[model samples]
Target: MTGAALAVALGSTGLVAVGTPAAYAVTPSDEVAKLPIASFGAMVVDDAHERVYVTDGRRSSGESAVLVYNFQGQRVGSLPTDQPVSGMALSADGATLHVSQSHRMLTFDTATQTRSGASFVPYDVTCGRDVAVAGGKTWFTETPYNDPYCDRPDNIASLYGVSGTSHVNTGWQSQGRLKLAAGPGAPDRLVVGQAAAGADANPFLTTYDASGETLVRGPQRRFADAEGKGALDLKDIAQSADGKRIAVADGAYGTRLLDASDLSDAAAAYQPLPDGAKSTAVAFSGDGTYVARGAAASGSTPDLLIQPADPANGTTPLEFAFEGELDGLRVAPRGLGWSKDGTRLFAVTSNGNGGLWLHVIKPPAAQHDSRFTGALGTTPAKPVVGEPLGIRGRLELDGPAPAEPVKVTAVRKDADGTQEVAAAKVAADGTFTVLDVPDRLGEATYTLRFLGDVTHRPAEDVTVTVDVAKAPTAVELTAPAEATRTGGVEITGKLTGQGRALPSGIGLKVTRTDRFGTTGELTSASVAADGAFRVRDLPSKRGKTVYEVSYAGDALHSGSSARATVKITG
Candidate 1:
């Protein structure tokens, strides 16, 4: 196929359908700058000033440099370095750019593109491949490139942190070293894909905090390997906008998802692509709902896959392939000064003669535009029998409020079955409240749903658990040795469980069965604050007597000890 056809097939737009397929601009609005480097390890863009910063490492002479370029593709400034550069990072504010070169960490001012600081903190491993700047600290990974087959050293991988104020040339002590899976978190935490020393030897995920302290670790989970051959290699990691979810690039195995809150296990909800693609780069959109992955194979152009951040319904990713040669691939988003309004993307290409090529990517139009916000609240649970209970919540939204009318519905289900209870519309501030749950109608679980005029986006339903309260659990009935018309019985017990105190009221009913087989209903009393119940006014009948306590609608019978022979007193 002609180059233009190939470019179109590879998801590029810059093309002319002529005899030889001429190359034009794809997203002319989105541009890229070239650098003087044979091969690139890592690169970052400064979208605020329309400039790009790249690490230029000359393999033969072992010389390294940091080169800067404008969005219009002009060489602006270059900084010479003694050691080769490996990874790069930009501060949250985009004021500083941190570069991880051979055995040292260097910083440059974003405004001037000059060396601001330097440090010689020899990383645990040689190749300081990935770098991230966040929370006032710089983080990078040291992975050995020498022996890819050898059993990775227990200490072969580590994440180093340096304060922004620390000079780049100072020989600083490593904040801490940790065994991670593959890609660590850039600015703050390091998300590793390997196992620490333990019985759970499977390849898992963990995050090391900014202080180089291990914050959270994921349960043992397996990933695909390099060739899509064995299990996956957790090679690259990226976080969603809200930082609640993490996307792990498993070479050949595809990408995996983990909960950012605890870094515990793969989210129960996730979507994996078809196996066989070698995923190299992973990135997330600002809202944390979309994720993009870059894939390529030997002797082929690279492809891009876009999927939902946390996909539950098995959906496929939107795939786009690269048109020309794939070189230094990095994600430059907009909104953050380093990215163009956080929408455009740039891909660096390399020709045989050591020149740089650039490819610009424009995001597809947005699929949905509505937004949702709300505060969820639950009732004072664990109420005793016959107690009233419920849950309350509120919702908020932006833009002209929906006026066509909205409804809030509550659906409850239990060991018995499911039932719908309440429905209401959103108030002016886009607020809605629900109250007064029914009595324990043998139900254990309840869900709340909000239906609006527009079905494009429905408020997610919330779940509330309804369980039997244990307060006033057990009741004891004691009869006097001699039957007496004035003497009664005392019932005392503690209520305990996840939910015990029902707000409305706590009532109990007592019943007695005589030896004559006749059953008599006794006095009913409200349970005390301590879940204690006492009833008086009993019959002086002899033979044997049985006592039972009923709370709400469920009944409990006391042990046979509550039954005993009675004699009339003098």
Candidate 2:
């Protein structure tokens, strides 16, 4: 889709859009700072003070530190740490910033530019990624480095909590650990995703109550599957303001949306990018209307795709293509603070020198929409069979709301490469339902076309792919063997795999071969609750007849039953 089309689609959401830029402008004013060295770690923004914080691990000197800056990219001060600072977090008040380095957590008083009561207690294991602060405590992921096994033991991957009130020399105490327990809310508890387990790693998202002793494990969200194809090496996570949703950036899965209410089944409910974009950092807009995902790249020209909360209705995201190189390749998003009004977004990055890059996310001009916008707010670019893909969309009139009715059509191309199936006249609410698309051989693209009543403009189309069965299976046919000549034919069958029912709503095409040496026309049917189908009024020809079942897109066919001779002997 063109950038203009993407903007128009998203404009329906009442948001201002910007056009795509030919090239990013690099002004001397855009230069943030020059780092002391090349190493990079984490970057964050303090929205309250309009300042940014960036950390340099100082792997060479072992005296890592964080640098502070004003919104204009001027370096204000630098706070030094005893060990390498790998991950960082800012308190809600933005007065205290926490840094994790060499298995220790230190609180820095940003106002005083000094250590707050000597860093907090040190952790037992090295942290893998970013840290989050919530409910008066600091949370970090502990992935033990000693384990030789590919998957870290349950104890190796834990969410260690340190009291914000604790002093560094006082020794931070462990709050609680996440584990499997039985109870009404037991399944909701979060666990740590297995580290280095490839696809079999299961990560838990655990949270604790006030006292911190009684552990409340929310749910175990698998980071990777057994095959490692969808493995999610989650690097960063940020929750929406209302805490209703959490956006996680997995190395392999891009960004995953989790329902905070039910953490147990949230992984299964996640929506990932079809293009398999790798996300290095994630931050939710203040109001929770949009999410900004930072792509991990060393080059200055990185494409950041802004995904919307809803994808089914063709809401494409806004993309900001950067012009300069990122100093820190492994840099985590630091100072992720939104404006009080939620209008502006700020991010910090390492420029590979001793300098830091201050990234300001401003709303693009009203007229220009970037290329990344085309990917947002739409259904997954690719929809898997049996999934109840959502579609939330709005119609845009040239001037005012249309005076007459609008017709929305969903056209599904046959997987067989020959036929086209269509559904017309969607409801007034701009909604349509398509079920049981047959498991075709290759990729099938579905287009949604909207026709305005009085407007003479051409119809608008949104293209999305549909993936067919991953394994080969025969199409089952079920119907009455002997039927009355006057009645229609009811065909029914189950699509099974390894003795289990396939995912629901697989579409299939049924055809009949008559003894006359000519092939009959094809008919389509969606899988039902029992995987059964009934097609009435199948026109019968003379002599014996044979019925065959096949998928819509592919040429594969199911085993045909013996011909049932239809003798019309008068």
Scored by TM-score, the top model is 2
Which run of 10 residues does model 1 get worst, by summed lDDT?
Answer: 1-10
1-570, model 1: which lDDT tens digit per residue?
112111111111221112111122232344444455666566677765677677753432356677776665567777667677767777777788888765678888888778888876644234345676644566665544453322343434545556444323212122222222222234455555552222322355555555433233333345434543345355466776656677676664666667776654564534343234466667665445456675543333334555555655222234443444343332221101114343544555444456654545454434322334544555555533344455556654434454344445666566656656655555776566555444453446656654322112334556767664433433444445555545554444332222234333566666777668788777665666665556554566655556666654233211221233344332
For model 2 the TM-score comes to 0.50
Candidate 2 least-lDDT 10 residues = 1-10
Q: Highest lDDT, which number?
A: 1
lDDT of 1: 0.50
Model 2 has a clash total of 65
**RMSD of candidates 1 onward, in order:** 20.3, 17.7
Q: Write the per-residue lDDT of candidate 2 for residues 146-205, one digit (tens) a residue.
A: 433313334334455665544222122221222211111212222233324322354434
